[model samples]
Target chain A: DVKVTQSSRYLVKRTGEKVFLECVQDMDHENMFWYRQDPGLGLRLIYFSYDVKMKEKGDIPEGYSVSREKKERFSLILESASTNQTSMYLCASSLGSNTGELFFGEGSRLTVL
Target chain B: AQTVTQSQPEMSVQEAETVTLSCTYDTSESNYYLFWYKQPPSRQMILVIRQEAYKQQNATENRFSVNFQKAAKSFSLKISDSQLGDTAMYFCAFGPSYQKVTFGTGTKLQVIP
Candidate 1:
């Protein structure tokens, strides 16, 4: 079976702390994405990488950045975590250009105090 | 730019009954894909159904099916014989073969006993 694994399932960080969320997909999908999920607001795209070292800002990318050093690994970085930034972080990967389907990891819940 | 909308934020259905979640989207591209994703509580998010833009027939998976209307740009999901295990947040997503996918706010469905 295909799998998308997240490094942390839950994390608690202080305000202004540097945070890192790592995701790795064994499916060898070319496109990887980072999204922040919040109540009522649903999932908002933060960043996505179509190829290694190629990243694009999604609708809500202001406070986050991403790195794709390898085809299977994509990382999300929060330069300065804030209280407002606390939310469930989801990592997803798709096989092709179309959203044929997105295989998602079991999400990392980040709590910024 | 592509946008997806899920007007119903919350819905409930009795066990063994049926319910539908509505989704609408706006996109200029004629060729794209629509998808329904399910995220159960603290569980991995997975694809429930998907429909190609060019196909006239809707997609289905067991008891889960989609109602795809191309001209109206509306794609809805129907759950038949609802079960408690079906309680989850459902998201509608849209994108073309070469573009980033857009997601809606999502609908939280509760299957009552």
Candidate 2:
């Protein structure tokens, strides 16, 4: 079975603070993604990495950045955390195939105060 | 850009009954895939079912089945013999071969006893 592990399950940060969410996958998948889930708005993509050192911005990438220094790890960084940034962040990985069946980690819920 | 839409924000079903969740999407790619994911309160997103655009047959897994209408761009999930364990948020997703997957606003489903 594929395993996607997130570094944190819950986090709290003050306004304007820097925050980082880490994810690691054991399946050696080539594609990784970060998404934020909010009520009504659904899960909006933040950033994605197709390969080591390669990154792409998604629909809602503002105030967020991503790092993919290695194939197994992907990190999401918030430049300046705001209350509006509080959300459940999910990390997922998939093989570089047409199937696109993703393996997702338990989400990290971040709260900004 | 590919887009997925889930019209129902919340749905309720009696235990042992059936419920259908609606989803629609827009994409220009000829070969694509559709997925239905279930996220429980634990926040772990699990793949429930998937359908290939080129295949005429709908996908099914245990109590879950999909109604895939390629021409209409509609993919709906039907849950049979709904159990309390089935309560969760269901998300509809679309992706082209080896590309980023776009998710719809999820529908929260509740199974009532």
Candidate 1 lDDT tens digits, A5-102: 99999999999999999999998898999989988777888999989999989999998889999999999999999999989999999875545688
User: What lDDT does model 1 reach?
Assistant: 0.91
DockQ, per-model, please?
0.64, 0.74
Question: For model 2, how big is the CA root-mean-square deviation?
Answer: 1.2
Q: Per-residue lDDT tens digits of candidate 1, residues B1-113?
A: 88899999999999999999999999999989898999998899898988989999888999999999999999999999999999999999997863377889999999999
How many clashes does each candidate structure show, in the order listed?
0, 0
lDDT of 2 by residue, A1-113 (tens): 78999999999999999999999999989999998999998888899999999999989999999999999999999989999999999999988764888889999999999
Best by DockQ: 2
On the 0 to 100 scale, the lDDT of residue B100 in model 1 is 75
Which parts of model 2 are misplaced by more than 4 Å?
none
Instruction: For residue B10, give model 1's deviation from the true position in Å.
Output: 1.1
